[model samples]
Target: MLSILEKFDIFGVPIKLKTIKKQEQFKSSQSGVIAIIIMILSLAYFFYVISLWINGKLIPKVTTSQRMIDYTTYEWENSEISFTLYDIRSKINPFTKENNIIMPVLLEISGLIISAYPRLLFSTLQVDGDKNVITIDKGKLVLSQVDGSKEDDQEDIKQYFVFFTKCRQDWMEEGGYCADQQTIDDYFSTNHGLLFLSINLQQYNYETLEFDEIKKTQFFAFEEKSPFYSQVVLQKQQTTIDDGILFSNFKTFEVIKDYEVNTQAVSAKFAQDTVITVDNIQLEFESLGAFIFRIDNIQANETILMPKLGEVLAQIGSIVNIIMLLKILSNMINTAMLESTILHQIIEIYYPQFQHVQITKNFLGQIKQVHYKGVEIKLANFQHKYNQLLEIARTKFTFNNLIQEISRVQLVLINQIGIQNIKNIFKIEEDLKFFESDRLSNSNHQIQNLVSVLPEESPKKSEFERFELFNSEFPS
Candidate 1:
């Protein structure tokens, strides 16, 4: 009874004897954390639900029909299907007002990149990524025209995206909203394979005290009828990012499988200066970069359909001379016969007695009288010839006139050559422009180190060929 009473006894009857532990002894969490967490989880759930709904919508309905699709895959060199870049200024020092602000430069630039349609073949741009390398599996330049199908090819379509998806939950935990966009993957279906674009670390603007905004952007040309999908993602690279970038003013684009230009140039070189040579005249561009297509090795000799105008004209001139000479020789061979023989023959045939009956008038010593109409006698010039027939031959079949008509053909050929060469060069110029523009626009193609042919005439061609007015090649 005594022990029990002592345990239950009011021991601190004196106020000074009572005491409490320190406030720091108890552990607690920050304010509003639970609410924010709940909110975030709810949103995540909502997004998931929306995704499910979208999938549900895409589910095919019951149908019965014959359908065909070509399961095709293509490997394109340096086909940069997606790209993402950022300009960031983080508030590393909150007191300095240098908020870790991410300037999404690519967001603004996204709307400007026009998709360059893939070509039938491609030339690669060789580059050192410092960490990675790409080697080709095939190098043959064989191609037929693009699709003749009514529907456009899907893989050739052009699209772009710039995105940064982060754990809004994690960001909320860190008191931030943005995540760095670091990787991009292009899913071109089973036939086309997938293409991935990764940011080169060396290309990053790490100490971004300021941002160099990308202005004056435009669309790169693409084939007019193609279809493809695109995606962009922002990823972290030893850094934290905040905020998403917005894109403006982008239109859809299509691609072509077969595009025809009047002139095309392809360059190819052997691998590492091989021991044997197959051909030296053709420039090897296959080793340089991603080519939508490689123009085949054109046999210039085969394409040279025009002969030297001077040579052909000279031959024609010789033919004319020969014909003139032949006519003169024929006149000499029968000079007397053609004149007097016709008269004699005509007189004999018309009047048989003319051959025996002759009245002669001699010169000064003796009496001489010219033959009468019935006389079958020879004369220097025959007036009894077929004048109508000779006139017809001279008028309708003159060798000189025939030569004049033939000469027109040569002039026409020269004109045609001039016009055709002009057109060919112009066409080459135009295609070269497309190639250059495509090379520059392709993010994967490292064109910064190489020089490409210009859209206009080459420097030498412009200075020399343009002035060589009398060259046989140009055919004035």
Candidate 2:
């Protein structure tokens, strides 16, 4: 079984050759250097794989893609939005010389007044439109859309007109009088107050099963004289997250706000078009402080977390295979070096005259030929001779044959000399010589009788038979 295994020339399996002399098992410095280099490269490759795993490159990855959507037909049940107005009142005292006492600005959304001093006054408001309404429920604001709204047409969509005004009929009636000229001067002073509008949007979180709020705030400084109008476009965003652990996808809704203020100044006559009138009484306020919020478009983004364990393993295996190519090259170098050494030894042993022969090899270190004293021997011829020598050594120097030859030589000495004479010659004690001369004499007499019964002309004689015949003829 071992011999069968040795016959197999498997790569990377080292099988020691018993036929080759131990000293002739050749090694070269080039092979040793190549082996060291291969070891270093293998270590480097292992570390490289470890680094990729440690850096999260071998884990799941997130990818995102976005596309535009029509807001009219999209659902808004998973989202909530609200707006907050801040810093509308002046901090300076009205009685000071500067007299920078700006009155609190009121927020008019869908004809419902929201006071700045007390924050939001009305929790819900319904406008006289197709399906226009704003309501705050469960700490979140909801905007209702018209049923069966057209996708391409947005004329009937609910547009929230938020107006920041002062000195309205309700304000005057509450105070029981109008502001004096000094108070009016403070309202329009050089240090105009800044209004900050914060739009809070909440989206459902699938992982945590909760609502996550995102706030976008923008500040606008009220103009001292002319009024400007701003247009706010609220866009809807639908995001889908692929959870690897759960092996499922979750969707959430988000509202994004984009606004632009018209820098062109509007005259009082032109601003009167946007003024809110109650019982034919025009409200007194600046024209520049109004925002029209409308939901017009939607955006969809999908995030995918790709699990890549198999791919990472495949990548690592490919890299290892590439590194193993160097190991194959190292094995080839060692094999060539060993073969060249064996060839030189064979030539020196078989032909002593070629001891000083010049051996030639190719670029790959293969033994090509041996040249000595105008005679040349090719590699094939040298290998043939080496095989013949191996066959002869295997047949002649076997263990069993060597043992048999030693046994035969011992028998001949015992028969020729008596056991007692042999013991004295070898300095053996009397108890050590177990066999007696009578037993030996009886064995010789039986051998003589057996030889006499044999044919005179035998095709072949055994070594013992020939030895016994020679002894009988010479009367030894």
Candidate 3:
């Protein structure tokens, strides 16, 4: 019997129990075609999804808005103070080899018998120029003047007092007054009587347009507040002297002040500083424990890639391809284990069995041709039994066992019902023929005696031989 699945063909492929074997070889069948289509489409979509992810294009349209958030902060600081070390000099050609100067400023603190003094040293000038020297010596910060007694040597030497400050904001807020030398002098006198230097400036005179002879030398001094002072002040000035002019105060100074720094709504930036520069002077203040730096007011710009429904379906399709592959494997296994090859083998092994059943059917057909009423009823009953047995065997064991079981049932019918019924119908037809024949009375008597001697239960040998002879002689 055919299974429900086996009853139909889809896409030119037979859906039989044993068809799985065909799939194992990748036959050109409906299931194989469908699987191939699924696999191809699924893989295509899978790759498409991957490409979208790579290009960052998988985000859905609905999720484009970002939620705004508020954050409060306190105490903004900078790692290195942003203060100008020098006013941009118009005459200083920094790129020219003749005027370009590289200065090394060292901040050093001496140890115990080392005087506990902080020193600033100018190294290259003492070694190469030999024109002047600046250092912290004997607990005093000093600057020695350059000797340019001759007019020719005067123009090469330049002098300036360097000032540095701790805070950039204070310098900007003070309206430049904090840089005034007189203000620094007054401020210094109140704090301590610091030593001050008075010297003449000659190199590259801004007004004279030429360096002239320096006619005087002077000593200057400043007191150390503390090496670890959280706030320190610096002053830089140029000294000028002439035949008609008297020595006077220098230019500018810087001072540190103590005030409460405000902290409030500070936005944070999620970015890096792209430009970096070095500081001319760096301070380490033992008075301040920590110097905190902050970069704020930056907006957060986080992005996420979200897949669309189509992309999700594509992913599911890829997964379904895997299931299809598994199903193919399952089909191959079932074909190997359960699908019947026995039917084919039975047909080959039981050829004679089917031949015997065919012979019995032929005999029943002959009995029908005779059209004897009584024998037709018996033949019909036997034929019904024959058909039933054939149905049972074929339905139960499938096509493979059909021939073998039919042969067995035919043998039983031939012995019990089929042969006797066919012989009886043949004998009745011969008797009717004998009556209708234009034969002698003796021939008729002989035929009647031959029929009587054929016993109802078991016929004699002579009588059976005579019946065969009469059957052969009977008209068609």
Among the numbered candidates, top lDDT falls to 2
User: Residues 1-476, candidate 3, lDDT per residue (tens digit)?
Assistant: 46766668465754555343553242434445556776776777677766765454454322112233222122212111211112122222111112222121223221111122222232222313322233222122221223324343322221111232222222222222122444334433432222222122223233332344342322222233421111121122222222121232223211111111222221111011111113323332211011112112222222222344455666667676675675675456444333223332333243322222222223112324221222222445444544454454346576556676788877765654456554554555343455645354346645644454234444344553322211333222
The sequence of per-residue lDDT tens digits that candidate 2 reaches over residues 46-155 is 78766665554444454445565443422344313333322235533321112213233323332232212222222133223211112222222223444655545453
Could you list the CA RMSD of all candidates, in the order they appear?
A: 53.0, 15.7, 29.6
Candidate 2 TM-score to native: 0.45
Predicted structure 3, TM vs. truth? 0.20
Regions more than 4 Å wrong, model 3: 1-33, 49-290, 293-476
> How many Å off is the CA of 61 in candidate 3?
27
Ranking by TM-score: 2, 3, 1
Candidates' C-alpha lDDT: 0.29, 0.48, 0.32
lDDT of 1 at 305: 16
Per-candidate TM-scores read: 0.15, 0.45, 0.20
Q: Give lDDT for model 1.
A: 0.29
| Candidate order (lDDT) | 2, 3, 1
Query: What is the C-alpha local distance difference test score of candidate 2?
Result: 0.48
